[model samples]
Target: MQNNKSAARQYVCKRRSDKMKITVRVKPNAKKDHIEAEREGEYIAQIKAAPAEGKANNALIKLLAAHFDIARSRIKIISGFSSRNKIIEIIYTRKQ
Candidate 1:
């Protein structure tokens, strides 16, 4: 049992790298906020806020943080800040 736990930790460390990037197509002013995974490293986000004053972008980050089960500070919008298509980078540290 001890060996199995060690192996599982190693497997998780290998699978979850320190950082990853994902592309998202955001639909602002939606009825509700939700995220959909279209494919590997791709997603669709529906936000309840309008695309103004960075409201939609903030909502997207919040939604993604919850979906990925990471802190909001770990997610960054790397590109397409003012457009529907966005590239986000997530950085996280695995707990032992």
Candidate 2:
């Protein structure tokens, strides 16, 4: 058994240093709506609201904020507001 502790530590450290931006695919107005986490996972979310009048987009922001335990103001819709796919930018400072 060789020790690879240092290598593992570095990888974990780098991940923490990076602020994660997740891309989600929205499926609106399905039968009994739900959210599913992908295996290659990037915050895949589903909503019951239709993609109209910015309703689904608003719902997405609220759901993500609640799930991540962050303020709604922190998550912004960077792009794809009208499309099914969206990019969300989550900003946070490094933990002390």
Candidate 3:
């Protein structure tokens, strides 16, 4: 039998983590901005921004922030700032 009170408590008190890392393959100049896929330890992100003047990088951060349901300031690109494949770090997040 389902205990309504216990289920409600669990749902209301979900665990939240402070940080996480994500490996992302960014596709710049795509028709639209979206997440293409997710693998064992990586994610594929597609954005409409061109890969120039840090535009694509910025777009990737925004896309990731939205995807993870976090603020833009909480997302940081940890590596591969100059390549299509990048590693992102998300801090102070609550994932359900």
Candidate 4:
């Protein structure tokens, strides 16, 4: 069945655990500052900030750093600009 094949593919994908890539949906032109993760979607993050002069991007980095308990340098904007949707790459590094 198609459903079974999809499930099997997903299972195989989950088993191969590697670097994680997260996607976030930013809400620009917000009144206050806040960041919240979506309940249903683990990769989806709701950010409250205006998309102006990379302000939203900066806020996203700071907010994600706090959320993941990682340093700001670990979070990198891999792609997506001039749009509400952004793809962020979280790089993990061992402490020296």
Best by lDDT: 1
lDDT of 3 by residue, 1-96 (tens): 122222221111112467667677788999999884454446678889999999999998888778767889998888889898787777874447
RMSD of each: 10.2, 9.0, 11.1, 7.5
- Worst lDDT 10-window in candidate 3: 6-15
TM-score of each: 0.82, 0.70, 0.75, 0.65
TM-score of 1: 0.82
Clashes of each: 0, 0, 0, 0
* Prediction 2 TM-score vs. true: 0.70
What global local distance difference test value does model 3 have?
0.73
Model 4, position 96, has a per-residue lDDT of 67
Task: Pick the winner on lDDT between candidates 1 and 3.
Answer: 1
In model 1, the Cα lDDT at residue 49 comes to: 99
Q: For model 3, what is the alpha-carbon lDDT of residue 50?
A: 97
Q: Is candidate 3 or candidate 4 better by TM-score?
A: 3
Error of 1 at 34 (Å): 0.7
Clashing pairs in 1: none
Candidate 4 at 79: error in angstroms?
Answer: 1.4
Write the residue-wise lDDT of candidate 4 on 1-96 in tens digits.
Answer: 011122221111111132456666677667655566442223334456678889888888888888778889888876777676677777666566
Off by over 4 Å in 1: 1-16
Query: Model 2: which residue pairs collide?
Result: none
In candidate 1, where is summed lDDT lowest over 10 consecutive residues? Answer: 1-10
Q: What lDDT score belongs to each candidate, Candidate 1 first?
A: 0.81, 0.67, 0.73, 0.62
